[model samples]
Target: MTWLVTGGAGYIGSHVVRAFEDVGLDVVVIDDLSSGHREFVPGAVPFVHGDLLDTGLVEGTIREHGVTGVVHVAGFKYAGVSVSRPLHTYEQNVTATVSLLRAMAANDVDKLVFSSSAAVYGTPRTDLVTEDSPVAPESPYGESKLVGEWLLRDMQRAAGLQYTALRYFNVVGSGTPELCDTSPHNLFPLVISALVEGRTPTINGDDYDTPDGTCVRDYVHVSDLAVSHVAAARRLAAGEPLAPVYNLGSGTGLSVREIMDAMVRGTGIDFQPEVRARRPGDPDRIVASGGLAAQDLDWAMRHTVDQMVRSAWEARRASRD
Candidate 1:
């Protein structure tokens, strides 16, 4: 079955598109290019440069491409910035999702794989989050994502929409040199860009109660995350059952200090990260159990911390040249 991948020109979306191709599945792309690069999409793939807000364009693309499934990845993804730009975030994430769902229903595209976020958990009381963990989204971005999932559930009851939302934590590294993370607010890009420019990467806080006195997070390689997305799509296409949500996490986590060390080793840059005061609402640690995903979606942490850093550095460096 053919799939329409929204935001397919973005870093993670590009990788997910490639994964679908690697599995010999027919795929098409729909991206607005606001935060995506047209160059990331292959020359051969049919690309529709448009936004999900335009319901007609979205429905037309699905019908023209014979898309039976959709990988919904396009949205406002910045969590910290969403606090200030709540309306913009809701418009992009929540409203866009509703529009896309309407288009899918109108076109009889019943299958979907939603790219959700671990932000829905906010600052979980427990370190290891499970699929059943309470969802208390702290930012507009997260809240929008939760609403997107709700819409899918409601659609399932109303229109027989078969869907699965993969909640991801800190996604980093690169699947290819042509597609590297360009998010201004992501930690890896921020740190790597600083080092590339001969500046010290500053840690947000160093006095947390973690092993290295810094916040701990689940950092997964982009390629690994993409694999799970494809698996989810395949399961849905094959008419197999899937959980409502799955956490694509590392189970364990790494501290910021640990990542800094990996970056030093990966880039051969000998420097200490400058420690700064904790950002407001920063959690000490947030990791999740990927056991459910591992069973159904073929989820696994295939890259080590060093590998993650090295791949990301290579791609970032190549982008500069």
Candidate 2:
């Protein structure tokens, strides 16, 4: 049975596609190329160019590819941007998800692994976010992801749709140099691009209540996150009972200054990052406990912070124009 990966050409989705390839699983990809690069998809894999909002296109791809399961990864993913473009955010993340679910039901495709976000928890009150943490999304983007999860929950009860949602924390690093994170809003890219262009890196704030006075976050490598996606898909395909949701994160925290130090070692740049005012809505610290994912989805911290910095640096350098 072929597994269809929506948005399989984007940074994270592309890595998920490679994980499926490494396991010798037959897979098909459907991406609109909005923020994804078509070249990221391998030529051997069947690629469908279209949007998930088009139910007909999605249903046709499922039928043409004989898809039995899906990994839903496409969405309008910028949290801050969603604050201003609420309508656009909901349309892309919520409505598009509804369209996808409808297509899945029409085609009798029941098994799915959804790509949720830690933003569903917003700024957690606790030190470590767990699967049971209260969901309080602060942005339209986060709200959209939460709605997608609810849709999955409703469908499961209504139509017995077999599914699991993985709420990912900060996803960084790269599995290959060819597949690099290119989003302008991400930290790794911002620093790497500055270093590449011979500009000094800047930190947003340094007066947080954390140990280093900078925002602390759980950073997991993209490759590690991708493996868990594969594991979740395998469990669903095998009809093994799995949790409805899992947190894909490192059960630890890293301050921005600590990451800067890592960048120095990883990129060999001997410059201090300029301090700036904190961006509004920036949380003090938000790390998650990956114990649940580790126990069930083959999740592990396969890369260190320095390794994350180095991999991102190298990939950025390689993909420079």
Candidate 3:
């Protein structure tokens, strides 16, 4: 009854690991420690430091632990980087997933919960996207995830593998007081770092066609997202029929300027942000319906924008303490 959490040492993965452990489940973590920290895994859980692309290692770990399911969270996630490093992104996200699939097949690990992203939607023709929305990924990162879902669907059709791919939108905030996102790619931490370091948080574009003239995204707290994964895993273990996809996000949208306002108010810091041009592949606005996750997983985001800000601020403060 153990679950293997790939990239469990990462910001989001660590949170999911904590959530699973809190529910009294046996958890084993496999991380390459490339971007993830080894210290993030709880001392109580067994941690394996390795690459998921290694079929032998992946199968061996699953077989050794009697793992029944895997939460595939490892890979390159930065949308901007994925554009520049398309080959590397493909190798990490797509190739690695294929290798993982092979390993799961060999080990008889029939269930998986994949961490997909809203980037798969690209610049939507509309503001709100549903699970059935047309996937026009602008960058390689999104393409890789969409491809992963495709692979999972095919594999499920051929094999008996059951899976649920959760397409996340703007995962922000901290789950616990100890685990804050240290990644430089995310908008929340990037802004917080800039402000904390006495520099301006750079705004990508000021002239977007949305309110506040900046990009708008749905921000889901990390804890709520983690809880959704837990629920998805439990439901799959209960022999629930697999739908193969769900969007884990809040239906509400928040503009970049609105997030900045929340960060300032939550941290009691008033700092001006530098206006800049738009990044190459950024969508003007990407909000989700999240109706599928709400109905299927029975999950809802409880934390507001202010709560996200406060949690990140507290984690940052704790880091410095």
Candidate 4:
């Protein structure tokens, strides 16, 4: 059965596409290349360079390829930028999802795996977050994602659609050097890029309540996250009962200082990180528990912090060359 992977040429989406390939599942991709690189998609996989807002295109691709399911990874994911560009974020992340849901229903493709984000939790009061955590999204991007999940829930009732949303924390690392995270807003790439460019990495606000005076966050390897996506898609395709949402995260998290240290070890960069004023909306910590995902989706942290940093560093270095 063929599955359509929306935005499959992006960083994490590329890894998800590879995961499905590794399992011998045929797949197709439709990405506008807004933030995704067209070259990241394998030549053998059919690639449609288009946005999800075009319901007709989505439906056409699904019908042409005989798509049986979808792994929805396309969206506007910059939480900070979404604050100033709320409408764009909602249109990309929310309106497009409505179009996708409509296309799926028309094609009778009832199964889906949604790529959700930890931002949906906003600044959680609890040290460890779960699927049941309150969703008080602080940015338009997050609000849009939460809304996407709601659409899936309602679609389930309206059309008997089966779906699952994986709300993962900071996705890092690379399955291969060609598939590194290229987001300018992501922390791993920012640090690795700084060191590569002969600049000292900076840490914002060291006076946070967390130990080590830095924000703590769960960082899951991108490859491991992809595995869970594939598992969720498989479960949905099989009509197995699944939760509407699952957190793909490391229950325990790393402080900003710890991540900086890992970068030092990973890249052999010796300069001390510059401490700066904390950015607005920065929280002391936001770590989600992946207990539920582990039980159902075969989710696990297959790589260590050092492995994560080293792989990302290597991949970023490779891209520059």
Candidate 5:
């Protein structure tokens, strides 16, 4: 049984592709290379450079590869950018998903593992959010993801498609030296870039009601999240019922200041960060329970914040070198 991984050349997608291969699964990639790197796709897997919105190309790829399942990871992910470009976000995240599902149904490829986000649960009133948490997305990126999940649910009910939507917190760390995250919107890389250039990493929102008055977030290793994709895919293939949603994370929270301190510790670099006003749509604190994932999917994150920072710093350093 072969799999078609959308956005398979991107940061987390490439890592999931590698994880799939590690477990002996046949893999093929379809990426537009807009935010992904061509060099990230391993030579063993065949890649199709195209958009998921192109139904004909997507359908053809599924049929050509004999793809029995898909891991949908292609979408706009920048929170602030999505706000300014909501139309583009909707086009890439929601509209593309609808088209991709239709193409999958047409091709008889029904199984899927979706890459969702914690942004779906806006500013959580409670620190630890479960799968049952209220679905209130604050940003265009979050709303688009929620809409994607809704699309899958409706499609599954009507078209017999089975899917698992893994709502990720902040996905940090690199897959390998070759697969480092290059997103300017991502906080870790942005901080790393600042340190590399001898500039202070800026910290926004110093008065959030958290322990340290900075925004707290759950950070999960990209590799661990990728492993969950592999596990979920295999379980779906083995006839497990479609458990539509699960939160993926370390089940702990780290503040922005703490993360910066860890980065400084990891790199032995020091510069007092500039304080800035809270950005719009920025939440005070967000952490995942991930109990459902642990119970149903047997997933648990093994990487610590220190590990996450060290690995991320290592990847960023190697990329700069």
Candidate 6:
């Protein structure tokens, strides 16, 4: 079955595309290049440069490519910035999803894999979040994703849309040197860029109630995450049963201090990270239990902290060249 991967030029999407290729699946990519680099897309894959909000364009692409399934990975992903740009966030994440669903229904494409986020849980009271945890999204970005999932659910009831939403937490590392996290707000890129530029990386909060007095979070390698996407897509194509939502998380989490120490060891930058005041609404810990995803999507923490740092550092440095 042919599949269309939205945002397939971005870090995680590009890796998902590669994973599809590795499995010998025919895939097409659609990316607006807003935050994704064109170079990240493989030379051999068919690419359509356009926005998803254009329903006609989305429908034409699906029909032209004979797409039977879709991996919806495109969205406005910055949680902190979404507070100021709520409209833009909704337009990209929610409205765009509506448009895509419309086009999918029009063209009879019923299978989908959505790239959701852990932010949907907001600040969970418990340290280990399960799939059944209450969804109280605080940011517009998170709300948009939750809304997207709701749309899919409603569509499933209305049109028999087979789907799964993968809720990601702190996605890091690289499957290949050609693709790397470039988000200005992501911890890995921010910290790695600071070190590469000879600036000290700052830890947002060092007084959090954790073993290292820093915020603890789940950080999964991007390649491992990509594998799960392919698995979800395969399951969808084969009509295998799947949960509506799955959390791709490390059952246990690591602290920011531990990440910084790994960066120091990996990059040979033997400098301490600066401690800064805690950002408002920052939770001390937000790790999820991947038990559900582990059983269904073959999810596991395959990369160590040092390996995540090393792979990300290598890819970031390569991109600068």
Residues 185-222, model 3: lDDT tens digits: 88888988888898888888988888789888889999
What local lDDT score does residue 29 receive in model 2, on the 0 to 100 scale?
A: 96
* Predicted structure 6: clash tally: 0
True-vs-predicted CA distance for residue 283, candidate 5, Å:
2.9
Per-residue lDDT over 86-200 for candidate 5, one digit per residue giving the tens place of the 0 to 100 score: 9999999999998899899898888989999988988888878988889899889999999999998888889878898999878898767777888988889999889988888
- Model 5 root-mean-square deviation: 1.3
In terms of lDDT, model 4 sits at 0.93
**After superposition, which runs of candidate 1 have C-alpha atoms over 4 Å from their true positions?**
none
lDDT of 6 by residue, 67-136 (tens): 9999999999999999999999999999999999999999999999999999999999899999999999
Flag clash pairs in model 1.
Answer: none
- Clashes by residue pair, model 5: none
Question: lDDT of each prediction vs. the true structure?
Answer: 0.95, 0.93, 0.89, 0.93, 0.88, 0.94
Question: TM-score of each candidate?
Answer: 0.99, 0.99, 0.97, 0.99, 0.97, 0.99
Worst 10 contiguous positions by lDDT, candidate 2: 312-321
State the lDDT of candidate 4 residue by residue for 1-321, as single tens digits.
Answer: 999999999998899999999999999999999999998999999999998999999999999999999999999999999999999999999999999999999989999999999999999989999888899999899999999999999999999999999998799999998878889999998998888788888999899998899999999999999999999988887878899999998999999999999998998878789999999888898999999999999999999999999999889888887
Lowest summed lDDT window (length 10), candidate 1: 174-183
lDDT of 1 by residue, 1-321 (tens): 899999999999999999999989989999999999999998888999999999999999998989999999999999989999999999999999999999999999999999999999989989899999999999999999999999999999999999999998899999888889999999899999999888999999888989889999999999999999999999999999999999999999999999999999999999999998899889899999999999999999999999999999999998998
In model 3, the worst 10-residue window by lDDT is 241-250
| Candidate with better TM-score, 1 vs 3 | 1
Error in Å for residue 179 of model 3: 0.7
Stretches of candidate 2 exceeding 4 Å from the true structure? none
Q: Order of all candidates by lDDT, from best down to worst?
A: 1, 6, 2, 4, 3, 5
What ranges in model 6 sit over 4 Å off?
none
